[model samples]
Each structure stands twice: as C-alpha cells, then as structure tokens.
Target chain A: MFSPLIEDLIRALRCLPGVGPKSAQRMAMYLLEKDRDAAGLLASSLQQAVEKVGRCSRCRTLTEQDVCSLCHNPRRDHTLLCVVETPADVLAIEQAGNYHGLYFVLHGHLSPIDGVGPADLGLDLLGERLGEQVEQGISELIIATNPTVEGEATAQFIAERARAKGVAVSRIAHGVPIGGELEYIDGGTLAHAFNSRTVL
Target chain B: MFSPLIEDLIRALRCLPGVGPKSAQRMAMYLLEKDRDAAGLLASSLQQAVEKVGRCSRCRTLTEQDVCSLCHNPRRDHTLLCVVETPADVLAIEQAGNYHGLYFVLHGHLSPIDGVGPADLGLDLLGERLGEQVEQGISELIIATNPTVEGEATAQFIAERARAKGVAVSRIAHGVPIGGELEYIDGGTLAHAFNSRTVL
Candidate 1:
C-alpha cells in the first residue's frame, strides 16, 4: 500500500522468522521515519555478513575464517568434543560459560521422517575426527543437542558410533531446569528428574 | 559472542523497534544460516529506500519523486484535503477506502513541551494551499489527526486557521468504535457517543 521501495523493504523483512505483513510494514515505516542511517548500516551489515560469513570447515559453526576462533584456539580442549544441532545452539553453550571443548555442529538433528540421516548431519567428518589416526586422541565426545525426542535419538546414534570407534561418549544430563517451578514442569521432565536423581 | 560480521549484523538489527539483543541475534543467525539470499535482498532494499525515499514536496508524505503519486493524481479530489500526522496514517486512511481526498502530512502534532509548533508542522505551506490565489479552490480541510489531547488541540488550531482563511474545516468524529462493545467502552467515549448520536 506504500511506495515501491517501502513495499519491497516490507516483503524482504519477512525473511526474518515470525515477522508477518503487518509487522514488516511497521518495521519499514519505523526505519524510514526514525533511523534511516541505522537502516543503512543494517543494510550494509547484512550484505557483509552474507558475503563473508560461512561455516567453519572443522565444526560447521558460522565463522569468517575457514577454522573458527574456538576451533583454532590452542587453550580450548581439542581432546574433548561437544556435538550440537545448530550454530545457534553452539552460541547458547558458549554463553553458558561452562564448556571449554571444541564443537561439531550437525546443523540439524536426525529426523527420519524428514530424511535427515547421519550423512546429512556431517557424521562422516565426525567419524574421521574420532578415528585413531593421530597419537594425541580425543578423550570424550559430549552430545549437547536439544533435549527433544529427535535430539535423544540423534545422540544415541552418535554415542553408539563413537563407542564403536573406541572413543568415550556421554549425553548432556536432562532434568528440571535450574530455576524451574515443579508445578509448571511437564510430566516427562519430572520423570527424567526422578530417574536421573543425583546424590548429594 | 559471535564473529565480527555476525556481531555487527546483530547490532544493526537492533535498530528495529522493540527488538532487543536476543531477538537481534536470533534474526541475524536465522538470516545467515537459512536464507542468505533473502538477507541480501533485504540489505539492498534498505539501502535503496534510505537513498531514494524522501518527503513529498507538496504533502510532506514519503515519496521517491518531488511530487508523490497521490498529489500528482488528477482523479483524486484535491479540493478536499485530509490532514494527517504521518505517512503511516496516510496509508491507513487510504487502506480504509472511505475517503478519496488528497492528504497533507503534518509529520507531528503540536507538542509545545517538545518545542513543536505550527512551523514544525509546515502550516505555512498549508496556509498557501488554503489561500485564495489558486484557480481550483479548496472547499474543505479535514482534520484527521488522532484523538489524543495534543491531537484535539492541533485539530482545533487548524480548524480556526482554515476558517479564518475562508476554507471550511471539519474534524473526524470520535466516540465508540464500530466493532467496540458498549460495556468495554470508556466513560468519555460513551458520553461522546450519546452526544453525537445520529438520527437513524
């Protein structure tokens, strides 16, 4: 309903997740009216990110370099690997500040219905990483995928593969969240919490 | 938290209204990971919009050209001018399809505390439009600003000026909305509804 440029901006803005027509229009108008300079900066930033950023060859996490900063850092535990589903999940773990291991991003979990297999998750490269090629070997493989059914199935598959390759494997623990209320927690989570109770 | 390019994109995305750091990061990751082409398109669109779009010379609404398409259209009733506060408001009125008059955008209402005055709203240009020198005379000026305190005061001021300049002035009526429930309607709106009841 606006000028061609505005309409185009609104249409393009729908590329972001959860933004519909109304929200896109509002965003376009806001950028045009309030912060054209910031809008210009945003435009340039987007173009640069798309052109420069790509998956790290080692871990599949997003990075400008072939090897990501984390993967290239010698101080981080290269002998320990945490496998995750996506780049966003990697960011989440990094922000948590507990993990010091190198990462391997699957980009997606194994979904049989969706035809996502081990190969699709880049397990062939993971197999090479776990193989006893170098004298200095990886000690543990931590499965840090989401706690959903697909994530569990994927973790099981990866764990079996790692064990067959003579490498230790462990899945991230699942129970109630740190500050979660018992009443609001789901039954499945409560069952997991009960089954995996840790002794004081 | 992310690469430099990714971080810049996230920061730039925060320029959007109501989007905080988390949402900006998510949006940036989504664009980079899933839809890089669309992100590129959005970037170009933002740049083009910022470079090209400017206020219409006559109406002060957003337009690419010197004269906006609305002001240039001979089919529209130029003699019946609707005054609004922003380009978004102009789009809203157009979408409603009830009014076929040309519009004059004020950009903002009379906010004396913020030092906004008649000159800020381009009332000088409006005065010229209302003047007697025009071959095709303006018969009426419709004040379609919002129903806030500032809006009412602005409408009153514009109405008085238009009257002095020999142009008829009318304010858009306010009461209960068409789909609004009477029980949920505020007391002031209810009173206005009672006072402005039409003889049906």
Candidate 2:
C-alpha cells in the first residue's frame, strides 16, 4: 500500500506485461522516490516510440518510417533475409551481430486457433517481394523461429510456402544455449536433435 | 528478440524495480502487440505522474502538493502520529485501513553498512515533529517499520526517542501471513516466531 497517488500510479503501471500486483507497487514506489528522472524519461520514450515508430512497408520490421533502418542500410545484405515472428525477435537477433542480412517481421504466427492463416501473414505480398528480390540475386532465407512448438510449426509453414515460390529456405539450428549445462538440460531427444542439425 | 521500438521500450521498462531482463522484454513486446491501447494509457499516466507528483515537504511522502494527502487531511488525528521508513510502508498501513492518523515518511532505515544513520534518515526532524505532536496532545506514536532487522532497529530507536519525550509508543505485530502454510516453512522456528508475536 502507498499513498492514493502512488497507488494510482502503480495501478497504472500494472498495464505492463508480467508486472503483477506486487511488482507494480514496487515500481511505483521506486519511481516516486529512487529514480524519478529515469521513470519520467521512460514515460516519454513510451509515447514517442508508439507515435513515431511503425512498420517497414516491404519487410514489416518496425521503423520510424515506411522503411526501417535495416531496409534502408546499404551495407546489410538485402539478398539474405531473416524472417522472424515478432519485432522483438528481430532485435534479439540483431543484438548478437552475427547476421548482416535484412529482416522481415511477420508480426504474428499462423495460429488457426486465432483464425490467422498464411494470407493473414501477407505471404502473397511476401512472394511478390521475393520475386522482386530475385532480380537482386537473392539466395538464402533464414527461418529463425524460437524452439517452441508453435515456433516450429510456424517455421515449417513459412518454409513450405517460401519454397513453393522457388526460394531456398533454411532454419537456424535449435540446440542447447551456449552456456547451458546438461544437468539442467531436458536433453532427452533434443540431444539427438542438436546432433542432427541439417539444412532443409 | 523484438523490433527496435519494442526493444527500446523494454529497455526503458527496466527502470522499474523488480523488473529484470526477461520480464521487461516480455512487457515491451506485450505493450506493442497485444495491448497498444493500454500501453498508450500507461505512457500517459507515467508522464502525468512524473510531471505532477512531488514529495510532501514535511514528510517526504509522495503527493501532488508540497504536503502529502495525510499531512493535509484535517480529519486525520494530527496528535496521533505514525512513523514509517518509506512511502511504501505508509501505503501498507493505510491499506490495513484501521489507523486514522497523520504519517511521517523517513524514506529509509538506518543501515550503517550502507552509511545510513540518524541524519541520513532525517531522524532529527522526526524527533522535532514527535515533540510537536506531544505538545498538541498527540499522546500516541505508532512505530510501524517493516519486520526486517533494520526496520526493527529503526522502530526501537524511534520508540526510545518518543518515550523520552513522554509519548506512548506501539509497534505493529508480525506473525504468519493470512494464507500461510506451515509445512513448507523453513526452520522449525517459524512457528516460534508465530507464537512470539509481540505488542509494542
């Protein structure tokens, strides 16, 4: 419990995902006392990003304009595309600095439970975009979905659709994390899955 | 991994207390994708609170005014004062909903290891305030610090000071939480702590 204003502020902060009742209260108190400046900056950043940032017209990656920074960058390999499920996923990949290719954000996966299918994913437009890329000598498409069941299903669906359009499709390997240990490993057959890393 | 905007958003969200790397990222993604409208509201709220909220000059508690709501409320028993270590603690007591009094927020406890002592916690002013309350027929002073060791020490120090000023002092009791489980308890002494709940 905090002051009425603090309670209201924390209650408002509860809107963030995974911020439960206790955490919202803690954050509210922290902001009210410890880091007011940072909290204020975050508030302004939240609004500015939402208002200014949108999707790249071609790849659907988040950007400040019709095209994202990566889409506009001359150095990134346009022919080597990295397709991911969400905008956050793209940032995670980019942070590793291993890929110099451009990205296409799906914004979602094909969840039939939610009535989202291939058409909803903009595959037709993506196919046309791929044809346009073919003129630019596009060669490789890296499907880097997460290792979850839905991720695997979505990757498979994307690969199948992309291959039908004459694009070579490959998936990133799913294995133990770099610093993961066997004791904590649910290795089971994934130990076998890690060994059988192959191009699709 | 996520879009740059979402990544920045999550990074910004980490300013909150108890929000670690993973949860901040999840919150960022959820705000952008599943709950854009809610995110907008939260952003507005954060901005508003940061812009408007300030500590009460008298108590150092969060409020829109120079004095907090408790300090300003004419209905609160000004003679009966409650002292707490943080603005958060003040809220906890208020939520308990039995106390009808004014509060003095210390903002922190005396942790000598962290270099926090009497002056660091504004204890001198607190002493003066306690004296003022006693002169105004404030016969009772509630020392409602947390159950932590530092909190206990704080309450002890304040109680001693108040007693010297001819004021009656009391401390909130501690026992099992409302839905506590004994079997999953650590150390057989939890039951002892439960049995040993103290008054004052």
Candidate 3:
C-alpha cells in the first residue's frame, strides 16, 4: 500500500501549469520507482517558487531579487522599454534572441470585468518612470501588451499618459490577430511587428 | 545573455518522460525565475538515480538492493511466483490490489528478431528457481506475461521448462484483443480474465 505522503506529493505535483491526472500519476510512479530525486526536485521547486518569486520593485517582473536582471543590466537600453503582460511573455521574447530593450512586466492585462485597473498594476510607477524622462534621458516606450480589447485599452491609456509627459510612445504593429498573444505568435511575425511598430 | 549551462540544464530537464520543448522551456524559466532550489534538487536526483537503481540481483526487478521487496517479503508465497514482462507491469498488478503474489521481472518480452532468448533474460536462474521447488515447498507458478504473440511464446516456454520440474504451472488468462494492455483494460474484464484462466 502507498503512503498518504506519496498521495499528497502527487496532488501537489498536479498543480503544475499543465500537468493532468494521468501525467501526475505517471510522474508519481516514476518518482516512487525510478526517480525519487526528480520528484523531490519538483516538490522543492514548487515550494521555493511559491515562497520566493515575486514582482520586482522596479519593473513588476517576477524576480527573486529586488530588481530583475533586465532592469538592472546597464548594457540594456533603459531609454527604450518594451512592456509585456506576464513573466511568461518575457521568456517567449528572450527565446527569440532579438529584443535588446528593457522589459516591464505588467503581470496582468487590464480587465475591467476582472476588476483590474491602472492602479491595480504598477501603472502609477510606470507613469512616474516615464515622467522622469529628462533626468533618466529616456526616448521611446513600446507598448507590447497583447492585442485583446483589454490589452488595447491598457496600451491606449499608457500611450496617452506617456504622450502627456512629452515622450514618444508606440504600440507593437498588429499582424498576428486582435485577440492573440505574442507568445503563441510566430517569431518572424513578432520580428516584423517589432520592425514596423507605429506611433500610438 | 544565457549560458550553455542554462541550455544544458534545459536539455537535461527535457529528458523527463513526456516533457516537450515548450514544457522544457517553461521548466527552465521556472527554475531561473523562482525555483533554483528545485533545479538543484532535480540535478542531484538525476545524478543520484543515474548512479544507482539497478536490477535486483535475485529477480531482475528494478531495485537499489540485491533482492527486491516482493522477493524478500516473508509473507509473500515464494512458491507461487508470478512472472511479468516489466517492472511497470508489476506496479500495474499491485495497483489492482488483488494479487498478493511475488514477482520475477523479465525486463522485456521475447523477440526472436531482437535476439532475446531464455538465457539472455536470466531464465537460467529462473530454471534453477523452478528446479528447487520440491525442496523449497513451492506449489504453483503463474505465467502473467502479456497476451501478445511474443508474450504467449515466452509464457509457453517458461511453463514447459517449469512444469518439467514437476510443479503445477498455469498461463495467465486472455480474453482481450490484440495489442491491449491490462492497465487500460476495464476492471470487469481483468477480473473475468483472472477468474476464468484456462490451463495451457
């Protein structure tokens, strides 16, 4: 007979982003039979991520430190910031290996129905970050939020706020779809979108 | 910039059964962004399992010791040995919660084209095991190999050899169709097969 501890371990493993019951069971058995170390690693990661990974103080990107690596790196252009919806999005862009600008992870797209607003995110800080243009010597703000209606609205709001501060602002060009994501969008289309971005 | 070490980590992570490129990427990002401890744990476990976990010396069942639990359990009917193709099959039978018999893991099915034979699969030891029945007080031998053609041949060969030693031996039942597995078969069918097993 299996122990309750093993059952609890399987249940916890099932909470991973896309792991289902069958996969969980396979993983559980694999851990129990052939790979207890892998199972233990998975468990430790779940606990560590839940406890440590949080929004970076500067850019809202998920980070183990106060500031994310992108935000702290001097080599990246602080003057040009490409904002994205989630940390997962940051990974997708990094995979493409082209984007050299700093990133601001919004964590969530604005969803009025979901009760998320400008203040719900770090929009105030973003606005302030943009308003420090003369001192920080900033130039462009690329609104790389998703093209869903909520994403569009958020982009527009940010663009207007940036323009009011007398800074140049642009949104990523639309080629994928109105409701699609940068993550699922192919790399070539994303490249073209980046190359042909227009003013908001 | 990402290092090859990161890539190596991702590549090693992708080796986990059923994990694809996207899942591997997500896992890598998860480790980097939030779960370094998990990564370390996984790394250690991979190294540990790779260094250990060989077949049981007695029964060829996957084990960290000379004898597997099923073979070592004093309560198990050592005289009534159940033969199976794989350790996974052993687990499946255990999950069914019916069979309380001990197991001898063959590690593979018979395939003439693959050059697998009785001697190659440690059948010599099995022969010795069966040959010792009168002295050890073993009464019955259960052939629980798969229902495939190769499985059937393997079971037949085992029974012929074991029965020559003068013990009551029976092949595990068969009612299911071709290429079907006992794990996915309905409990009713499995139960029926178990109860209605015929002598071969």
Candidate 4:
C-alpha cells in the first residue's frame, strides 16, 4: 500500500493497544505529512524510555531509577503496601490521589490456564518483604489486583502467606463506580455492592 | 506523573491522532512492561520514516523516492488524474481499488481563516502539471476533495483553473453512501443523492 519504510512504520505502530491496520496507516501518514517533528521526538523518547526505564526495585512499577518516586517519597506510608497486578493499575490508584501508601506490583495475576504462577509474579519476593515488614511494625497489605478469578485467587494466596508472617491483609472493595446508575450495573457488581454494604 | 523519560514519551505520543493523555500513558506503560522489543522497533521505524519519507515531487503524496510509486507505475492511466486534499485521502482511494488513474495530492484544502491559500496547497505546481499533462494527452482532472465548504471552494477553484488550461474537469459526486439507508442519511446528502440520481 505504501513504501516499505512507511509500511514498516504502520505495522510497528500496531504494537499500541486498540490500533488496527487502518488506524496505523492514518497515524503513519499523519506523521509523515504534518507532524514529522513530533514523530522524531516520539521516536527518540520511545527509544530513551526503552533504554532507560525498568521496574522499580522495591515495587516493580516501571521507572527510570532503581526505586520509583513514590517508593522514595518519605511522605508516603511505607507501613501500608498496596499490591496490584500491573504498573498501569498503580498509575490509576496514584491518579485517584486518595492513596498515600507505597505499592508492590505483582506484574500479573496467577492464571493457571496461562501457566502464570506465584513464582512467575515474584510472590517469593513479596513474601520476603512481608516477613521483613512485620519486624518493622507494618500494619496492612492491601490487595488491589483486578477483581477477576485469577486476581481473587492471587489475593487469597497472598493473604494466607502474609497472615503466616503476622501482617494484616485486606482486599480493595468491589462495587459499582461512584457515579454509576444501579439499573445499568452488571449483576456481579450489584451483588458485590450488596454483599459489601457498610453502616451509614 | 512518572519519570521524565516516561513523561516525555507519553507527551510525545499524544501527537498521534485520537490518542489522549490517558491512552498515551497506557501505551507507554504497555511498551515498557511487556513489549520492549516491539517498542524499540517502533521507535527506530518512526525515525527511519521521518528521515526517509518525503513528498513525491510530482503528486505531493508521501514517498521515499522522488516520485510516488503510483506516479511511476506505467500500468496506471496517466491521462486521468484524481486530485485530493491529503495523503490519507489517497490511501482511502487506493484501498477502494476502483480508481486506476494516478493522483495529485494537494496536502490541504484552502482555508482562509487558517491562512491557507492556493499557493499553500501548491496549486501553482498543480497548474504546471495540468498544463504539461494536457500536451501529453491527459484529458480529465477529477476533483476528489472532501465535501466541506472549504473543500468545495478549493475544488471549484482548481476546476476553473484547469478548464482555463483547456483540460476537462469533473467533481466527484456528493451523495449518500452505497449501503446507507436514506432515513439514516443526512438531509444534505439525501438532497444531493436526489439531484444526482442516475437512470437505471
């Protein structure tokens, strides 16, 4: 459809989520025609990010430095750890601005069908951290993984392991979103909301 | 917010069409977390394209060589040229596979408020090509610009100019799309379809 270079660019662009061939072509043509400077900047920035960014040593979130800013910040509660499945989830929690605790990224859930297990997500590392944190008077380990079958299993597994080390474990509440209408909510979410009701 | 490198990549990625800040962050995180190799490939490919791809001298569409393959291919009908406002339009026409004639890309339509004029669209070059093509037995110039007010004005301006050069000019019809139901179609398009009904 186009020069090999242009075609290569279009195909390479599909690595991003939700971008299909048609969208890839549009992006390629737009960069080549109207936004070459930005394209160049994106290219260099992507390369820089790939070359420099790696998991934070303490929490496993993507960061340029060994420890992420959140983990390094003294204002955040090191005694409270929020565990999530991926770095994107960590970003979502941070953006909400309600959580002032540090994070420990699992990178993925324990999906048996997909061959992902506790060892694969560095649960041993998490167990070690939990054991070490108990000595430092750490109070809670919040499981913030997505509310899927695998996520539930992983949370329960982590809870059992952390409880053995004398650390308290809690799951993030599952319910309808704040602005959601109940009529439009799914049955599973409605059940969760009903099951988790608290005193007014 | 993330590290400076991550932040820069996210910001630069917003230059792509339809990608907002959240989408950009998701893309950046996905690349960093899962597909670093593909991310590297995308970065290098973008750089390669920005460095190599330039407008075809004859048609103004993007190509690595001096002339686009469409203009260079001898099998295409050289006598009939389809003029469009952008390279994306060229891709759309090519994907339709109905047009066997060559293309002349204007890069953009005339927009007075944006200070885009005939010269801005390389209309003088188009005039030269029209004049030269006429001597070489080129007969028809198809104006395939979009149906916006600016696009219509640009089409008319080019039509008058080409007609003055003794070349035949035709506008691609504005009407309801082939599979679209009349009830679902816009009034302007339905009216156009009514006026341009072909005798079956």
Candidate 5:
C-alpha cells in the first residue's frame, strides 16, 4: 500500500525479535513522518554495530572490542566465573547488581535435537580455561543456566569437566522468586522451592 | 553494561515506536547474534528510505518518485478524493480494498496550540486544486480523518472549504466496528452507532 522504499523499510523492521507487521508499519511511518534525524542515527548505528560487533574472545559475549569490558575489568573477582546461556543473561545479572565475579556466556545450552553440542558452545575453550585455572585464578564455576532439561544436562556436563580439573562447580538455586505469592506460583517452581529449602 | 557500539545500537533502537529499553536490547542481541545479514539489510534499507523518500507532489504521501503511484494511476477515479491525516491512514484504507479514488494526506490535523495552521497542512494547495476542480475533474471530497476532537474539527474545516468551492463533501461514518459487541463497545462508540443507525 506504501511506496517501494517505505515497504522495504517496514519489511526490514520485522527482523527485530518481537516486532510484527503492524508494529513494523507504525515504526516505519513514525520514523519517516516524525523523526528523520532519529531514523538516520538508528541506521548509522545499526550499520556500524553490524560491521564491528563480534564475540568477545574471553567471555563469548557480544562486543566490538576483542575482550569485553566485563571480562577485562580487574576489580571483578576472576576466581568466580558464572556460566550462562546467552549474552542477554550477562546484562540481566549485571542489572540485578549482586554478582561481582566474571561471566562465561555459553550462547546456548546443549540441545541435541537441533544439533547444538559442546563444540558449538565453545566448551573446548572453557575446558582450556578450566585447565589453566591456577594461572587464570579461576577456582569456582557457577552454573547459572536456565533450569530446563537442556540447561540441567549442560550444567552436569560442565560440572564434570570442572571437577576433573580440580575446580569446584556450583549451580545457582532455583525456587520461587522473592515477594512472589505461593498460590500464584507454578507447581514446578513451588516443588523446587520446597525441595531446595535452606535453613536460616 | 554493554560495549560502546552495542550500547549505541541499543540506544538507537529505542527510537522505534513502542520499543523500550528491554525490547531494544533483545532486538539488538537477536540481530547481532542470530542474523547479521538481516541487520545489515535493515540498516541499508532505513538509510536509503530516509535519504530518498519524500512527499508526493500531488497527494503529499511518502514516495521516492516525484508523484506517488496511486496519484499517477490513470484508472483511479479522479472525480473523488479522500483526505486523510497521514500516509498510514491511506495504507489502512487501501488495505480495506474498497476505495478506488485518490488521496490527499494532511500530514497532521490543525492544532492552534501546536501552531499547525491551514498553510502548514498545504491547505492552500488543496484550495487551488478545489478551485480548478472543473479542469481536474474532481466533484466529490471525502473526509476520512480519524474520529477524535481534532480529527472532527479538521474534517469539518475541510468540509466547509470544499463546500465553498462548490464541491460535494462527506465525512466517513463513525460507528461501532463490524465485529464489535455492543456490550463490550465503549459508550462514545455506542452513542455514535445509535446516532448513525441505517434503514437496513
């Protein structure tokens, strides 16, 4: 219904994770009709980021630099490394403001059905890091992967590797979230909460 | 929490309509991690559209060409012109697949508080077109502006102008949507439906 360029812009906008056709159209119209300067900035930023951003060698997180700021920061405890499923998880943990250690982004957990495995997740590099724990000063590996079947299998696999290298491995506790009503909580979470109950 | 380029990309993505911080981050991650080609395509498409697309000379809708395809089409009914608030509104009517006439985009409704006047909406150009109606073959003006205080005011204002130029004018009907239930419909829409009841 729109011109070729406008239609192309709307189609391109649908590449975003959750944006559908209506939202894509709205965004395209808003950018064209209201804020052309913002549209220009977004275009340039997207181009530059796509050209420059890549996985950090140390942590496997998205970054323009060779090593991400989080992995390079000397203040963070290198001895404690938290493993997660994706780069977004690193941001989530940072926002929570409690973890003060390093992070290792797995990108994804093991999913054999789709052919994802240890090699696909850069597990060899993790194994090499585990082997050099004494030199790198990493003593404990905290598995913070999501509590799914694949996440559990991934955690177990990493734990065995860490143990073989004499590094302690721990999985983050999963239970009912703080301030969540017990009645409203899902049965699986409630069951996990009861089973993982800790004394005060 | 992210590297400079990634952070810049996230900030830029937030300019999109309805995209907040979290959604922007997710979009950025999905584009960078899962589909760099789509990201590059989106960036280029946005840049091209922003740089090339301009208002159609005849109808004021967005287009890369001098005149939009809709306005230049010989088969369309030149005797009837539908005036709308935005190009998006034109798309909406076109998608409904009934209107075969031409369109005139107001870009915005008149608002003295926002300093939008008749000249700002190219009303002078519309007036000139109306004055030359015999040459242009335009006999009827359809006001399809939204059903709001500003939209109604705009429709009324245009109706008076068209009438002054010896052209028949009509406003699009305002009533409950076809699929809407009376009990669930808002009071204002219900009242409009009652007021506009048809003989059928």
Candidate 6:
C-alpha cells in the first residue's frame, strides 16, 4: 500500500513495545508526511542510544557511562540498595522521591519456564557486591521487585544470598494502594493487607 | 532518571503520534534492552525514508520514486480518481481492496484559519490534472475526504473546481458503518444513515 522504504519504516516501527501494524503505519505516515526533522532527530538519537547505552557495571541499569549517575552520586546512601526487575522500576522509585538509597536492577525476574535464571539476571555480580557488604558498609538490601510469583521467588533468592553475607534483607510492603477503595481491592491484596497490618 | 543518551532517545520517541512520555520511555527501554538490532534497523529505515521519500509528482502521495507504483500501474482504472485527505487514508482505501482507481492525496484539508489554502493542498495541480481530463479520459472524481466540516468544505471546494473542468464529482456516502448496530451508533451517524438510505 506504500512505497518500499515507507513499508519498511512501518514494519521497523512495530519493534516498539505497544505498536501494532495499524499504529506503526500511522506513526510512519505521520513522520514522513508531517515531521521530517523530528524523524531525522529520532533516527540519530535511536542510533546513538543503541550504540552507547549499556548496563551499569554496579547497578545493571541502562546507562551510557561506566557507572550511572545514581550509583556514582556520593550523597546517596550506598548502604541501602534497592533491588528491582528493570531500570523502569528504578525510574518509578526515583519519581516517587522518597528513596535516598542506590538501586540494583536485575533486568528481569527468574522465570524458569522462559529459561530466565539468576545468571541471566546478573545475580553473580549482585552476589559479588553483597560479598563486599562489610567493606562497602552496606547495612540493608531492599527487595523492590514486583509482587508476582517470579518476583517473590527472586526476592527470596536474593534475601538468602544477602543473609549469607550477613546483610539484612527486607521486601517492600504490598497492600491496597493509598487512594484505593477497600471494596474494589482484590482478594489477594486484601488478605495480605489484613495479615500484615501494623498497629496504627 | 535515565542516562543522557537514553533520555534523548525517550524524548525523540515522543515525536511519534500518541506516544506520551511513559510510552516513549518504555519504547526506548524496550529497543535498547531487548532488541538493539531492531533499533538499528528502525533508525536506518527512518533516516532512509526521510531522506529518500518524496511526494509523487502526479498524485502527491508519498513515494521514493518519481511517481508512486499505484499511479504508474497500467492495470488500475486511471479514468476514475479518488481524492483523499492523507496517505494513511489512501492506505485504508487500498486495504479495503474494492477500489481499482487511482488516488490524489490532499495531505490536508482547506483551513482558512490555519492559512491552508488550495495551493497548500495541491489543488492547483489537481486543477491541471482535471484540465487534462479530455486527454486522460477521466470520467469521474470521487471525493473520499473525511466526514468532518473541514473535509466537507474541502470536498465542496474541489467539486466546484472539477465541475469547471466538466468532470463529474461525487462524495463518498456518510452513514453508519456496515456492521454497526443502530442502538450503539452515534445519533449523527444514525441520522445520516437514515437520510442517505438506499432503495434496498
């Protein structure tokens, strides 16, 4: 329906996470028809990011530098490291603005059915970092992984490893969201909230 | 919260239609983390299309060549020309598969407020094409512009021009879609559907 290059552009656009064929076509047409300069900039930016962005050596979050700004910042509490499944999670925590500690991105949780394991998640590197707990003066490891089955399993695995290194491990609390109505809360979350209720 | 290049990539991804900051970040992260090769291909394809693709000389649709394949095709009915608002509309009609005629893309509708005149919509070129109606053997100009006020005004404007060239002009029907239920359909569409009822 379109020229070869235009068709190729649409197909290539489908690589984005949520873009399907129709959306990809719309995006390709919009770029070609309305915003060529933006398209050019996007192309160069994508290329540059693809070439430069890699996982931070310490935290495993995506970064262009050897050590990410968050990890390198001396003001942040390195003693309290938060473990998460992806860099996006790190961003979410940062946006929430309460955490003053550093982060360790696992990239993904352990999913054996999909063949994702500890090594695939750079757990060995995390283990090495945990081994240096005394030297690094890291007092606590916060497991901020999602509350899915795989996330719980990953948190448990990491907690065991942190305990082996004589470091305390804690999982972030999960209950009904702050503004959520109790009537609308799901059974699992309600049950957990009831069980983990603190004296308030 | 991301590195500089990653942040740039996210910002660039927002140039795509319907991509908000969150979606852009997800797209950027997905491309960088999951598929760098796809990202590279998307970048080159975007750059190539932006650099190489231009409006077809005859029809004004996007194409890499001098004239689009649809315009150059001998099998299509050149005597009937369907005028549309955008290349995406052209693709939509092409995908519907019943139209065997050629197309003329307006790129946009006539909007006096935004200073978009006939020249902006290539109406002068369309006029020239209509002038060659005698030699080209064109019998009808099918106006398939959208059913918006601007689209109707543009269609009326083009209809007058085609009439001056002694070419018959017809607007595509405005009615409820084929599979749509009357109860769920909008009042405007239902009213139009009744107004444009056929003899069936």
Each candidate's DockQ = 0.77, 0.46, 0.12, 0.75, 0.87, 0.85
Candidate 1, residue A159: the lDDT equals 95
Model 3 chain B TM at 0.81
Q: What residue pairs are clashing in model 5? A: none
lDDT for each residue of candidate 2 in A99-161, tens digit (9 for 90 to 100): 998887788887889998878767676777767744475577899877677778989987887
Candidate 1 scores an fnat of: 0.78
* Per-model TM-score versus the true fold: 0.92, 0.75, 0.63, 0.91, 0.94, 0.92
lDDT computed for candidate 6: 0.93
Worst-scoring 10-residue span by lDDT in model 6 chain A:
A129-138
Off by over 4 Å in 2: A1-4, A92-99, A133-135, A146-157, A172-200, B1-10, B56-60, B65-79, B95-101, B110-136, B146-164, B170-200
Q: After superposition, how far is residue B185 of candidate 6 from its true place, in Å?
A: 4.9
In CAPRI terms, where does candidate 3 land?
incorrect
Candidate 4 displacement at residue B92 in angstroms: 2.2
Candidate 3 structure quality by residue, lDDT tens digits, B52-88: 5567777777665667777778887676788888766
Give the true-structure RMSD of model 3: 8.0
**Candidate 5 global lDDT:** 0.92
Q: Where does the lowest 10-residue lDDT sum fall in candidate 4 chain A?
A: A130-139
Residues forming the 10-long window of minimal summed lDDT in candidate 5 chain A: A128-137
**Candidate whose lDDT is highest:** 6
Cα lDDT for residue B63, model 4?
84
Alpha-carbon shift of residue B52 in model 6 (angstroms):
1.0
Ranking by DockQ: 5, 6, 1, 4, 2, 3
Return the clash pairs for model 2, or none. Answer: A1-B91, A2-B91, A87-B2, A87-B3, A88-B1, A88-B2, A88-B3, A89-B1, A89-B2, B79-B138
lDDT of 6 by residue, A73-117 (tens): 989998899999999999899999999999999999999999999
Per-residue lDDT of B133 in model 2: 33
Best by DockQ: 5
How close to the true structure is residue B121 of candidate 2, measured as C-alpha lDDT?
A: 76
The TM-score measured for candidate 4 stands at 0.91
i-RMSD of model 6 (Å, 1 decimal)? 0.7
